[model samples]
Target: DSDSKQKKKKKSKASRSDEDYVQSLNSREDRNKSWWDDFRESVEQAEPEGTGKFLFLKLLLNETCEIGDKVLVFSQSLGVLDLIEEMLKIASERGEGLKSSKGFYRPWRKGRDYYRLDGSISGNKRQNDIDAFNDTKKARLFLISTRAGSLGINLFSANRIVLMDASWNPSFDTQAIFRSYRLGQEKEVYVYRLLAHGTMEQKIYGRQITKQALASRVVDSEETGRLF
Candidate 1:
């Protein structure tokens, strides 16, 4: 009887917690459309645009091209990656065709050559995409999923990294950054972690920093072994 009572109490607590989490998630989604619109406009806007993703685009159009630098763009959500791909595609359609190259096969001639790697991409195809991004000047951007691109890949060619969104765990974001900032990287790497203003993203980014600090403190202390 005592065991049954304890189990029921735990179950009830879990249920209430899940319900509250669902409510919060629902509320966040309600504000999703505006966030996406802002993001799209930022990416699609022409040169000399204002802040946000537009700023990154401005840099890409101005700096990356002028200097022959590459960029790696990371996002945790596959859906977000898809949205970025769509925006890039639209930009391509507006006569932003690939820069002229000799002896290199151009797959899709959408303006601004680019590639995508996520959970949905096949291993062979992913490697192909990476090879293309690394070897060709035409392929200017690599769109990657944070979890998918975090480990076991070296993208030293890209000096610029755009974190389309932040992860709750800062280490994951760190891993994404290192993909470009690692050794063999000749240029000074630039990383941009974008967070939507006045949104849940900002809240999560603040929480991530706090979590990272706590983790560092725990690991650095002599008491860590004893506590564990």
Candidate 2:
């Protein structure tokens, strides 16, 4: 519905102008993620609120990982996924190899499956990413934006998912969970909902759930959880 944002500009030509614009956007995203990753430790410390989420996910995933074990991290924006990848990277870097300490297992995620939140991916690219995700030798994490990657995707390879941010639409949450909770999921699907306490996220998520049933019954439903 209205929750979907407009598609990014697309170019059908090999012009330098189009290439430059896309490159700039990519550069901006890279710079932003780099800055955030650098500040993530301080941010975590300043915001102890993440403890509830971190602990919850740790418990859900059992802090252990295996090949072909996929995880889809759901957030409101694409930028959040980038930050999460950095968090995962940090986790993997701090002596997180297989034969390490007590809680040192992060999944073997690839560089390509760090997809944007939407369906901006081309058909070929999507399949390649999916293939890698389902590959037993390569990937285990599939970080995605809730708004973009929630529907029409089979994420049955994962037994767990982490919702980085709650949405007003419970169906949005439902669709996101289906990425793992769908058919062929061998294990008990565990979905962790992360809500930022004492923020607009809490109120919006609560109100959104209340409206979920009602909204689905009508045609002209109000989409309160639209893009920021």
Angstrom error of the Cα, residue 92, model 2: value is 2.8
Q: Give the poorly placed runs of model 1, Cα more than 4 Å off.
A: 1-51, 96-112, 219-228
Q: All candidates' lDDT scores? A: 0.67, 0.60
- Worst lDDT run of 10 residues, candidate 2, spans 9-18
TM-score of 1: 0.66
Q: Where does the lowest 10-residue lDDT sum fall in candidate 1?
A: 97-106
How do the residues 1-228 of candidate 2 rate in per-residue lDDT, one tens digit apiece? 433432222334323222333443565577656566655787674432356665565444435343334467777655455455555555556644222134445443456433433335565776677666665433446777666677777867777688888876778788888888867778877777788789988888777766774666587665544432
User: At residue 177, what lDDT does model 1 achieve?
Assistant: 87
| Colliding residue pairs in candidate 1 | 92-111, 96-111
